[model samples]
Target: MRAARLRRGLAMALTACSIVVTVAAAARSTVPGTPVPPRLPAMRAETLPARYAANHRFITESEHAARALGDEGRAGVLARLARGDRHFLSFSPRGDGQVVEVLGDLAHADRIAVVVPGSDTTVDTFDELGTVYASLNGGARSLHAEMRKLQPDRKTAVVAWYGYPAPRTMSRDIVTTDRALDGGRRLAGLVGDLRRVNAAAPVAVLCHSYGSVVCATALRRMDAPAESSLSDVVLFGSPGTGVRSRAELRTRVPVWAGRGATDWIEGVPHVSLDLLGAQIGFGTDPVAAPFGARLFPAGAGSHSDYLRPGGLPLRNIALIALGRGSEVSDD
Candidate 1:
């Protein structure tokens, strides 16, 4: 009777959470955008210039569309992105849009870090060196800058990939893995491109919040050897990763997990539930002992503070990305 009562209570709580999230999401204004080209050139060292040109064209066109829609905020952002200095592997203006931006010399870098952002991220909110909490653009720039500071001689690169439509926080979608599953496939595709272009670079994926779930799903689909260039998976500020333990992930790379001392995600329930044939929660707190992820230090910060500039989390993340995980100080 106790077990049954527990399940019943969980179902009720989940239902309430979903309703609240859905209502909040409904109150937000949706951004208007144009459809991106259906096809683009494949990523290769020799074809990089062509890809840049294509992205520039897309950015220009998207800017025009945003201007037409009177969303000067997004139009201005796109205008800046179209500048000659910017480097984007891919760009799309559909829905919340997607951007794959490179922060360093990707063609020659020996170490690469892919920053996967969580919910409430969009092109309009993507900051370069500016401060915007949880912005993929800001986080990627911060991580790359930290990596360079730590190892000036190391050839490193960082990719800010907003390739998936991250759901709004506190929304019904965030409670389920549907978006994460789709995001994982997209992330896998991005990794495939990276491997093709720089097969020798050791790569680390730094996933935050909902992005952790996406990374876990992607890792499960990969069967790389223990010595593969994909070196590590780092999860921070995560609620759960859809798996109870690292062994279930089945990826050869080392899995690391951490949380800022005051991250709000710690309060989120870390249990899965079956509700009318649909799974309503991600399973397992990755930092928990049973999950088997190597722990790292995140210091004191909130949910969006993990990637803050000069923070301990950013430094350790850079260390892991550079294949120097042994040097990360968990204390």
Candidate 2:
């Protein structure tokens, strides 16, 4: 009886050990099927706040000056103004004294659009430029509204970038090109940050007016390994982007160009050769150009009508944002 009892106990012990071993093996085999999520960049809390403060200080001084001056004083007042109030400016970082508005979560956005404004644009003037001329001349708000309408399901963000020191006026001088290049670099950096924060998102750049010049310059200067993440580039009412040809821009990214027939840029000399002073020009008109951009038939409104509500330009932009050109109405 004693021997039988001992045998039974040993048998039970062996069974328990086997069960433990099997459970351990099962646990080891059950690895997670989901992918390890990508890490986001560590954004220092202080960095953005500090930048905002500087911007506020600059804008406050300018606004006070403008208020002191009468209606006649408004004529010479700076065309561009920073976007934020004193608190916003106080927290933001200064990048070439340009305006930078962060609209969405850079970490998980589905789509990102960067709107680079043109000549005489500053942080303050960013929004007003659209409203002052008429309801038809809507600015950043119009662009944002159109984008949201187009991409209702996806996370979309628009950056009203006034980062480059734009020319105060239209000038043939090299300063215009220099300022554009500066803006482009800043844009490139911003793009890099966006990508670092969310590698899966697509980024599109809309360069308006002289901002196109900056975009072109940045593309030309960007070397290999630094050029990815840009899915599309659109230029509106651009005189020139400093590239002799679209191919010279050296970007695999699709280039979209368009200008209203009545755009003043058409009248400006297209090229600057020493002997020609400013030549009529060569290369394709962005609107009619062979490049794959969806051409919007902007009527006689010139450079400023691109963002007007219910307009062809805004509709086309909306289509681009939504990733569907087929939805755009001809009207």
Candidate 3:
């Protein structure tokens, strides 16, 4: 009787999740306008400081326009951008999805960490306030603080990258690579842009969950920037890196993988497919022996706990961002 009740309850919860996801996806698709940020001139490392100012001006204009259009929520986003408190690398007010954040100084930071988030993230949720370093923006802020604590003399920056559309909770898209493939190329290109702007600094991509798929997509491309420009690619709470082996990634930089002991993803079968010779599910467990990623210790918790402050995962992520892998705990 207890088992039956448990099964029934689980089914009901899944059904509710399916309904919410479908409705959200439908609402997202029905919306016609995808608000784009105002155009700015071509960028160069030396001119990025000024470009940030110019972009902020355009965002402010758009925010006011959104207010006139009676979109108070969007206007609120614009208002936040207008506050001059953040160093935004890019922002798009129109889409339910986008990237609009930065932590610490970017123009001259000697080390940088670009965080790629996973499922169900949107522009609105990107800025959603959370307690205890729970939100992506908050987590980035936490990581930046950790970096500062580790090396007060060194400059550091963390980017909360959320440009790609995430798979909804029950959408079939979540089980497929339709989004990850595109997101991967964009992520790689963005890394190249960071490379050009901060030429002397070491940069890393800290991929969590589905974001690992995006990171793998870029690294597999022949045209992607050479490994020297990227310091590391770390996968945490990863589904897979979308490769047969780390060597298959076709990059020279060391690839690292970690998972908290309690992370549910650890039990997911590592398998990817190319149906009839087309790309599909990403395969290979990043932390498994066959995956060939340098295994590192992570804090004990579920998927979202990797970036929590005072945790092993956060500390190791900071160490990797600062290129101090030797300092990471090896348990």
lDDT of each: 0.82, 0.57, 0.75
Cα-based RMSD of candidate 2: 27.1
Task: Kindly list the per-residue Cα lDDT of model 2 for residues 241-306, writing each as its tens digit.
Answer: 766667878889777776776788775444333222322222334554543445555555678887
Decide which is better by lDDT, 1 or 2. 1
- In the range 146-229, model 1's lDDT, one tens digit per residue, is 999999998899999888878776566777887898899888877878887888888899999999999988887754642266
RMSD of 3: 5.1
Give the per-residue lDDT of model 3 (tens digit) for 182-292: 888788777777777777878888888888888888787625454467888999999877678898888888899999989988755565544445444457778889889
Positional deviation of 146 in candidate 1, in angstroms?
A: 0.6
Ranking by TM-score: 1, 3, 2
Estimate TM-scores for all models: 0.90, 0.66, 0.85
* Model 2: residue 264 alpha-carbon error in angstroms: 1.9
Candidate 2 displacement at residue 103 in angstroms: 2.5
